[model samples]
Target: MLTNQAIRNVANDLDRRWISDDYFDLIVWYETEVQIHGFQLCYDKPGRERALTWTRERGFLHTAVDSGESKPTANRTPIVVADGTFPAGQVRREFIARSGLLPAEIRELVLARIKDYEDRQSA
Candidate 1:
């Protein structure tokens, strides 16, 4: 089964919790082929990948958190990013892209970074 392994420390969008520097949910699954800055993840439930949908079909768009709607998956989950690394992910990349920021310019902006990115980037 897929699972969350860590969270990145930084900042988050004021309107959305999914894309943030404070807590970027990092997921790991051997079956997935996603490579969003070396971190593969799932924003929605299992089998809900938007990239698989037809071009004419509507893709998954995240909704703002609702009061008493449901609990987040990472509630009390024991995982975190170390001090030397930076956060990264598709959510952060998209957020930056949407905001007219280039991928190379933004280092500390991301929704999730791979758990081992710093080690890999350094090597």
Candidate 2:
């Protein structure tokens, strides 16, 4: 299970730009770790798809420009990179399978745990 603090920490790291282009690959790395640890986390499929589309589109354009197949356009908007998109649906499915919990159930559990953790920390 992923705690709220853990998620916040990752977000903060991202805000600091600690994760670079290679951060996309870290999704697989974290998923693997979760599998080995027998933990489950909630994932939004639609959100994942959006991320995939974003990363793929940007990566394709980047490669085209680098190989001289395409030229950069000053009028083109900069590509927006999202958090995790690697392995797409597979990551979410594997996580749910390994955790033996439905996505909604996992989300509820995580939320409850986060509340508990926050309460304790505050006290």
Q: Per-residue CA lDDT of candidate 2, range 77-112, in tens? A: 423343432343454444334433324533344334
Candidate 2 similarity to native, TM-score: 0.21
Q: How big is the RMSD of model 2?
A: 15.0
TM-score of candidate 1 against the unseen true structure: 0.19
Per-prediction RMSD in angstroms?
A: 16.6, 15.0
Total backbone collisions for each predicted model: 5, 0
Structure candidate 2, residue pairs in collision: none
lDDT comparing candidate 2 with the true structure: 0.29
lDDT tens readout by residue for model 1, 1-123 = 222234444454111112222222322221123322222232323322221111113422223222232457534532222232232344445444443432332223222233233334568
Instruction: Count clashing pairs, candidate 1.
Output: 5
Q: Which 10 consecutive positions of candidate 2 have the poorest summed lDDT?
A: 60-69
